[model samples]
Target: MDGIQEFNPFSAGGLDQHNDTTIPISDRSSQPAVLQPSQEPTPKASASAAQVELLRQQEELERKAAELERKEQELHSRGVSMGPENNWPPLPRFFPIKPCFYQDFDEEIPVEHQRVCKMMYYLWMYHCVTLFLNILACLAHFTVDAGHGVDFGLAILWFILFSPAAFICWYRPVYKAFKSDSSFNFFFFFFMFSFQVVVYIIQSVGIPSWGNSGWIYAISVIGTNLAVAVFMMVVAGFFTVSAVLSVILLKMVHGKYRNTGASFQKAQQEFSSGVISNKTFQSAAANAASTAAQSAFQRN
Candidate 1:
């Protein structure tokens, strides 16, 4: 009975022992602990990742800056402007005379002023054509009346001299004024173009022996040769049209100038500054000063 009691499976003590045995092992050296709530991301690791991202952004910005610098250097090396290049006088690549100026109405002129600028360009072209035709008319006049040789020679001289002079003086100044809103250029255009208008009037009047085929000359030849008179009349009509257009354009330009907010003070300031900055002007001034000093010293 004693042995049985000691080994009893249903005894209170034995049941208590079994309950203790069934409890999980406290000393589990081989089993891994449950993934302890994944350790909170370390601040250091997070900082490292952020730094990496920053480095990538910094590298990208540096690359863009380097590329921009490279492009600027390339442009400088090629002697090209960062803005649009000059493509005026769009001559053929093979032409002996390269373009002397750069003109782009769309690029340089304001949208509001482009129409007026284009009209001015057209006027210049018409002026050139008129001069050329005047030469032909004068040749015909000379043919009909041998005494008109002076008229023919003067016509040739006017065509040669006036064509380029008009382009350089009044037309170019107006073009520059519209392009840059330059106060100095505006004033220059006003002064020069006013004179040009007067010249146009005189040309249209066709003073005899003055190298113009104007109304007076045309009427004078009416009884001499009908065909020649008609030819001269046609040329005279062209001169009349040129004069009228010049007057109209001069008025238009004056109106535009009034709207430009350019003052005489501003024009004077620009002129002074331009003269000071011009290398050629500087040299000329220095030479003149030196000469004056020498002359004064010699007089003493």
Candidate 2:
């Protein structure tokens, strides 16, 4: 009985031991199945990941290319060139005129002479305004005296003529003088502007029936009519101011010219160049030579 009990096939302890061993084997098999799926990725998922990686690389390449292009453009604008190609005076798009004729003021005008150039330009603008006011003053006078038509007409003519003439005679010459540092242009502008200053003084004098209400009209109309007197006074004041400014500018320009050595030597050279270039002078010289040769031949 004791041996049967010890080797019993229906024992609870033996069944429990067997169940524990079998449970371990089943858990091991389940772990391997779970790990196998994780180790081997699906074909569709791998292909999608590869496509995403290629797209990321393409974007990175494009970004690098754009950065390089931006750097190249920046260098080009600063007068830096790759290879032998250089663009100077980088022209504006849709501009009809060439950049050579209209130089960039900020880049071309020297720092030393910029102030003088600006002052000269301002003077020109002042002159234009003065002329316009003169016309208005003439019209006012015309309203008072219908016979002052001549004054109005002459004022208009002066504006039309002087505007262009001033630009051509003084402004452009001074501009060229500063731009090129030419002694001849400096002398030309000095002489021309000197005459212009004299003209300003004369215009400020306010001659009657002449389109200006200078000091003369301002004083003359004082007791006649207060309103007209005030108007004349205002006009006279404008003229006086214009005259004073013109004188001051003339002095300033003269000082600059002196500093540039626009002396008698430069004047002579300019005059000689002009005479040589003049057709009338050339013709006169030829005639004189011919007459002298005829006299010499006759004497022989």
Candidate 3:
């Protein structure tokens, strides 16, 4: 009866004892402990294996995203362009098969084409400068000759009329020339500007006037003017006729190539204006170019 009383099963006993000396180290490490509910992430691995599995999945997703970005960059390198116009690496080269067939038929220009083109460019620039000067001269005449009030008024009027015209005829055309690839447009502008120079000269030389006819509808001046006016007029005539002849010759020389610049400009505009097909122009051009390159390589 005494032994039975000493061995009470419900009492705290050896099973509940926490003596480190009696416990196996591996078993102690493996055992679950009473944990505090935490607001913070576990620093020293209180994490359950299930939580570790979730972190692995997140890492996999980020890795996949980086891989996809790398693949996109690779595809981009193969002459595939994005955004409008598909403008990518590899532009067209000049003299792509050098007019070999036309060598015999193509007439050598009597004048050096490059020199003529450059001269015409210089002439157009001069015409613009001359037109601008003409405006200034009229303004000078107006200030100087107040007694000839009608002449002053007429000069001011001429300045207003010609300033905008000169901008359109010379400034805009020069901008176009720089943008253009056509050999003809280059020379065409050069010849046509002579006319503008002539007009400028006539206006500069004569008394303030109402019309192109130098003698008709002339303004009266009280002051004696310099002979510099006459020199201006002669210069104007030379330029005007030169410009006129240039236009005529250009029309004759490049009747067929009139649409060359127009086509290129239209294509560029269509891309910018959101009217072009995504893969039509640049993609096709790339494909054709690459095919040509491949063929060239194979032959070699």
Q: Among these predicted structures, which one has the highest lDDT?
A: 1
TM-score of each: 0.70, 0.55, 0.31
Report residue 194 deviation for candidate 2 (angstroms): 1.4
After superposition, the stretches of candidate 1 with alpha carbons farther than 4 Å from their true spots are: 1-85, 283-300
Those runs of model 3 whose alpha carbons end farther than 4 Å from true positions after fitting are 1-120, 136-144, 147-300
Worst 10 residues of 1 by lDDT: 20-29
In model 2, the runs with Cα more than 4 Å from the true position are 1-104, 222-225, 270-300
Give the lDDT of residue 209 in candidate 2: 67
lDDT of 1 by residue, 2-85 (tens): 566347888887898799668466765776776667777889999999999999999999999999999999988997778665
Query: Across residues 101-158, which tens digit of lDDT does each residue of candidate 3 receive?
Result: 1111113222323333344444545544544544444444445555545654564565
Quantify all predictions' global Cα lDDT against the true fold.
0.89, 0.75, 0.48
CA error at residue 109 for candidate 1, angstroms? 0.2
Q: Is candidate 1 or candidate 2 better by TM-score?
A: 1
RMSD of each: 7.8, 19.0, 21.3
Candidate 3: minimum summed lDDT over ten consecutive residues — where? 98-107
Q: On residues 1-300, what C-alpha lDDT tens digit does candidate 2 reach at each position?
A: 656756554698878767755655455654444533467779999999999999999999999999999999999898666654323335666766433334344655677677777788778878888788778766776677687688778888888988878878998788777776678888888889889877778787877766666777556656655676677667677767877877787777677777775677876787789889999999999999999999999999
- Candidate closer to the true structure by lDDT (higher is better), 1 or 3: 1
